[model samples]
Target: MLWFNPRHPSFFYYNTSTANLKSNYQVNTNGLIGQTTALQSVVSWNKTITKCRQNSQIIKAQKLFDKMPLKDIVSYNTILPGLNQAKNPEKVCQLFLEMERVGLKPNEYTLSMIFSAALNTELKLLVSQIHARTICLALNASVFVGSALMKAYADAGDGVGLGKVFNEIFNKDVSSWNALVSGYMELGRMHEAQKTFDTMPDKDVVSWTTLVNGYIRNKRINKARSIFNKITEKNVISWTVKINRYVQSERFVDALKMFVLMMRSDTMPNKFTYSSVLDACAGCCCLLVGQQVHSSIMKFGIPKDVVLSTSLVNMYAKCGDIDAAFSVFESVQRKNLASWNSMIGGYCRHGLGKRALEEFERMIKMGVKPDEVTFVNVLSACGHGGLVEEGEKHFDSTETKYGINAEVKHYACMVDLCGRAGQLDKAEKLIKEMPFEGDVVIWGALLGGCGHHSNTKLGELAAEAISRLKKDHPALFSTLTKIHGEKGARSTVVTLRKILNEKRFRKQEACSWVESPFHEM
Candidate 1:
């Protein structure tokens, strides 16, 4: 792999097959004067700019940048990317304004930098302003600039707006179309997204990747596979994207098949692909596949990445291989809070509450701060173990010890603990006193606790809360029906049934691509 060494005096070096670029450089500079004026030398100034950036001499670089007399697009491009590296987009904007105040103009790279820094909501407006500004400035409308604009609008989630931009371009290329399609995919507008994919006159790697990702994002896995099968060429990116989709759709067998095919074809897997494949096996509870993937990752001598390692741990735990999960966890050189939390969440989720709580405490004692997610797993431990007093102490410490405020899940845990312990009155009071209306989970937890305690009054309150929740789940509907029947409230049951029917039927015809991004932990 060719690596750029900007830190070295030469500023660039790599294991290329040849050192002949130096020969060409010498030949190109043979007849040309190397240096002219003492104060203005392009080669010297360029070198200075490179060093200034390498050393992070922000103020000095800006000064040298200002003193330069003869400059070009290359000059501006150099400083803009480095300015972005320094993470002062606001100052980068100032530099663009400075370039504009003079007769100089922006190119595609400049606009791309602007797009990378823009606020998501304000993007379309700002991009339009930019187009207007460019027209008013009489800068040549370049395809690269137009493509960058299309990307900016797409990234902003304005697919229709991006389409409008796409249609305006006369000689649109694959990148232009890809941007619009990618935009639609990001917004989960699969129907219109499919339309864009069908109408594209020409296709490239980017075009396929965009559509493949869109189909997967929209949960049109079959369509994604159809597109993947039809591809005339494949690259590492295509492999990763397709494998990732299979993983995302919770189809571990398909992911494993693709990985074996890629490996047999002599296509090497990178860190990203390895992580995704392992994640897929873990998600589908394919212990055999999980073990094979783990062996491959090890054979490749890939470092134990925290995300990859955690995925293995959780996968092993999920697939009833707690020993493997613990072994993987202990094997990693470094561990993040997510590493600790995943195993804890897994343990609690699978009824290993005691182990989960022990791991949580151990994490805290090691100077690792427990986040809200950690608390959620610990609460699950409390729920399973019936440690009501300890659950309260941990819940209260969220704000008191960790300075993390109690969220809806935390409140849900408290309601579950209290209601299960036969403190129905306090649970009801806590639900009402919650800073916000609790979600379906909190209500469901309360309902389950009431069923255990046989508190019909609190059950009624939970049913009401469930009815008001945003997302409908099987549990809430069933709980309300059971609660109404248990209390002999025929009217409430009829009302609840009507609401559930309405929700099921009146919601849009679009298939939900959502995979419950919401998590208790």
Candidate 2:
């Protein structure tokens, strides 16, 4: 028989490697045997449960927990964390209730787990109960639990709750400050977020980046740039965010300049960085700079990355090099849907409709699902090539065959197709019967087709529709006036001039793309 010490837990050590298998163990104290045995059982169960949890065997861990004959506060705490890690918040709450039922008092760790679990679930009343428990137990003053509560309130968009939690944290750390700033940013309260950031005793990279991202989210690009320049220690994320922002804002030239600066600073670009810069080149139709970027991509030894490959295809295609785009497409071995869409759109843009059609058929045959974008390109190809039958077939199959509801853009393509094929009646009927209202693009397509066919009656009607939205579009009005004048509709021309005079409309200067020669880096 082996004797166990009741007072000191560290005194008990069972070395199964050397101990006799048939030996019995008991507490040395006469009446404390049951208590010591229960303690030992709790420790053993906790060890096994923790091991199972670490190995991602939560189900096994729960089974062992359920089978344990003795459970203490430690047992409840161990299993609560495991359940939270497994993303079973509901089970975490259930286990918490069991802890309460058994009269086990919760520590700060347990309360933190409860708050963290409640933050993600849709159980509003759970948070309220947890908050009440924290108040009752006076655990609300704990920094760890307080921070968790702050984050939960932030996610719930309860400004009052967040403020209450923030004030409850008497000793705030960097994480506490970050949670408040991030919460404000998430809620789109830029002024409040900036204010909190300014009041922070020390600002880390995260603090700076959060404010920058907040400015970007609010569409204050200039302010975001201002804050970005103030960061002395900029990382790749800082550079990438600003670069992508310029691309999104359509400031392609500035975006290219920023990329050049980033390269000079020795800050390496990631796949997203390369993709955004390539998009900037494509937007400006800068073929020379685009090729230079391609060379840079190869030099970096990540030329085959699927996303970068797709961007390259898009860049080359938009710059009027369909062959280069096709070459890149063929080079990618594992092509995603985006890669196929880029290639098809490239062919459509360059007026190689028959080739685009062939690629579309091949895409479908390969069992790669084409999305709404693919069909947009496909319908455009058919429309440009005057393949009205093919266009109609694809248009009709959008909802039935592909599970993609035809959006307004797809309908606009169909209208352009019918209008281009001299089926104006079909186009008009389709527009009127569409589930949604036709935008300016749809009417503009009809007017372009009317101009091509010299149909003054429909042209006047389409121009009138456009005028309702774009009251000051001088070029569209000028085109309509010319069409009406040629068809001897002097009354319509006079009416257009009257509307133009009343609105004080002016014809804007034409903007053209002028790409400069690329200087080798």
Candidate 3:
């Protein structure tokens, strides 16, 4: 339900059990911390590494890794997962280079990290290289290792590699199957994922949920529900699975039905269930459903959870009841960053951009550091509400004061603002100054303001930029069409429509879940 809950993951009471992501580490650096058993075994050293990476103290973990009496393949393996978690997967490569420099043998885990880090196109090349290296190293690929490999290939959009590595495994475990299935689901490969799942020797909650999640994620609700109904024994995950699907799919009635069914089945819905059901209400844009869910949340009080509270606020806001949203927000005793972000987005969405600004300022005054996402929406508000000077000051502050580099979205907002104010040259100059590739959204934003200001020349340039995007985004195409039509370019509109007709186009739900992607702009 919440597009963005900025609260720390630890503060959120999720339904699932604590998973020790591979290559974890424990943090006992502080004096208040307990014994320092520099994880000797590879078995759980990864957990320790994870702790270090989480604390932004990977350097300490690195030191511990260096001092370990006997560093196994898992030792090197441990570092890569930490880097992978940081989202700086390039660091995984750097670590690999370091490994090569140190003369340590690169194991399957090492290669898997590289594969995991590769996104989209790069995944294809890396997966092949990793698969080949697996054979070259003569490494005995364990189920875990093989699963990781399948996961990498699946993530890369290489179904070929996914099938190849998956087929090679003689004795597959639940995790291996889950990995492959999850990968397929992630890449929207439902057909392949389903086929692989059908053959899984044993099915667990993870297996069933992965399929349901795949269907839900791919917007295949009917198939997901069909499989969900067949799940004989439902756990929290099972309930959450269906509830999550309905919430995401905006099927409020179905989610509520499933929740009731879960209670009847003697499976208690967890925080995720509550959050998702609230989300379904939000999606439905029905105030009554949200009120009902709110009462339910009250009856089964999850007092300390920041996420659920945030979800409630979002549900109320989305259901066209900002009064209720603020009422619940005010009731929250332990408000966190997500709480603020949700309320801000809700305000912004409801044409209360000024109020959103006030909330963001409240967050800053409360000493909560705003992430990039916070600035995006605030910048958007600046443009929409005509707070040009305020917008520029905040934009400049991101780099000059906070030391956070200005991303292109911020640049887009500034450009849009200036263009709306008839400062076309300033918008173009800002576009040129942007470090990242400007998206169609940015160019289109400028073009929109240009059109509003009747600046046809800049509009043409914005159209050109929109045309240059490597991949076609439907909304961008639509915006260009509108601009062209307004500027009397009916021929271009016809051409755009023809180009669009060649492809089966589905307008992805206009709802960009992301606050500015769950609470940013």
Candidate 4:
């Protein structure tokens, strides 16, 4: 039965059945021939299942797995990976149990797949049991298995378990070190992550990038930059990390300068690089820089990625080029929720409240669901246009229609909407009945509304509420003082400044920056 013919050297071509054998295809039929044929069928099934899995035909793979005549360790290994890839970890567990029931032992590959799936499943207890099994099977020394175990424990936030697995790894490679470092970073264990990076026998760009990113997360931007500058071979990602760090810190000028330097270099900018630079341009409202970025985007001929397109819309909008913003919005081949939100926000900012509302309606009709930001933009439009009824309807429908909970910003928009229409009582009532307490921004919104209506009484209440928050909002305080002065309350205005000075609440110094076309940092 285990015999191989000279003409047909493959197991798949080995036929033991007497009915199928011809003069040209000869086979020896022994007592083990039936078992050999069955084994051959199993092998064929395994190949089919593997092919199906590779093609991402998970359902078909499952069907093939279920219909197998006889399953073996190979069969289980073949299907388990596909199951894990499909995010069917529960199914993997069930199959593992089934393999055990049939007296089939899982190999190290099977254990690795389980750990990979378990990371996402958050099945910490199950992973623990699997770890014990790996130990009992004496497979813990495997670098592949050890890496997966480390990652699983890290994802579960089980740092101790991760360390134990790392200690047991016999041959730790760069990947192994990266997994542990990333794990430490994710858990905010910067010291431990840094220690691991320092002790690594070989450090790749990924290792450096991970530590740099960790420092950024911990708000150690200078340390991140210092580490970034030390990398001898800088990749696009390293440049992006620095650019992203600048963008996150609101250092728009620096971000744009980095981008310009990146463009001058041989390393081409990707979508993310363009996105960050566009964000900087938007922040600074630099139309020329934004237009330059727009031209680069065209020259690069990058695909219309949603994020890049949305950033372009935001850039143009913030630059006060509403027409260009709309043009970008319309040019988007597929407008996602972000694209719509940007357009609506652009309209709202330009005080084209009617157009913003129209876009909002069109968004809903086109079956694109509105998010919290969507409501924020639309409600803000309503406030600007004095559409109190529309604002109320949208606010009410936030939870019921869109399944989005009304956040503080949404409530602030509602308050502002009512206040804009001179419905001070309604605005006050809404604030009083809010689910959560108002923040400085919420009160500031109400105060601004009061200023617009010259409602000194409500303005006083709003100002008092803000004062109690003990925030250093100099602009709000200045506005309140101006409102009091207008209402013939000179003493009250003077007293407010005295209270501010007594509390040692000095106004924050405002700083702004612009990128120079001639000089690139």
* TM-score for each of the candidates: 0.63, 0.66, 0.67, 0.69
State which candidate, 2 or 3, has the greater lDDT: 2
TM-score of 2: 0.66
Candidate 4 C-alpha lDDT tens digits along 230-258: 89888898788778878887789988887
- Per-residue lDDT over 1-521 for candidate 2, one digit per residue giving the tens place of the 0 to 100 score: 12233455433333234443322344356435655665677788899999998866788899999998767667878888888876778888888887776555688888888877886578544676688888898888778888788777777778888888888878888888887887777677888888999999988887788788778777788898899889999888878878887888788998899999999999998888889999999989999999999998889876468898999999999999889999999999988789999999999888899999999999999877778999989998998898889899999898889778998778878878888888888888888999987777777777766766777878778878877866556656766876787788899889988877777887545321001110010
For candidate 4, what is the lDDT? Answer: 0.80
In the range 1-521, model 1's lDDT, one tens digit per residue, is 11222333222222234543233134233222322232135456767887897766666786788787545445676777677765567777777777665445676677777766563534345776776765564432456766676667766666666676666666777777787778778788777777887898998887888898888878888888888878878888899888988887778788888988888878788778888887877777788887887888889887778887887887788788887788889887778787998788888767788999999888888777788889988986887787888998999899988788899878877877776687878777888899886777777777777766656777767767665664565455656566677778899879877877876734332111111222331
Clashing pairs in 4: none
Count the clashes in each prediction. 0, 0, 24, 0
RMSD of each: 11.1, 11.2, 11.4, 9.5
Clashes of 3: 24
Clashing pairs in 2: none
Query: What are the runs in model 3 whose C-alpha is more than 4 Å off?
Result: 1-82, 103-116, 119-125, 131-140, 184-192, 249-257, 260-266, 320-337, 351-355, 358-369, 397-408, 420-425, 428-440, 447-521
* Local error of candidate 1 at residue 169 (angstroms): 8.6
**Residues 243-339, model 3: lDDT tens digits:** 8778666678888888778878877677888888888878778788778877776787756377988999989988889988999899888787778
Return the lDDT, model 4, position 486. Answer: 82
Q: What lDDT score is found at residue 203 in candidate 3?
A: 87
What is the Å distance of residue 49 in model 4 from its true position?
19
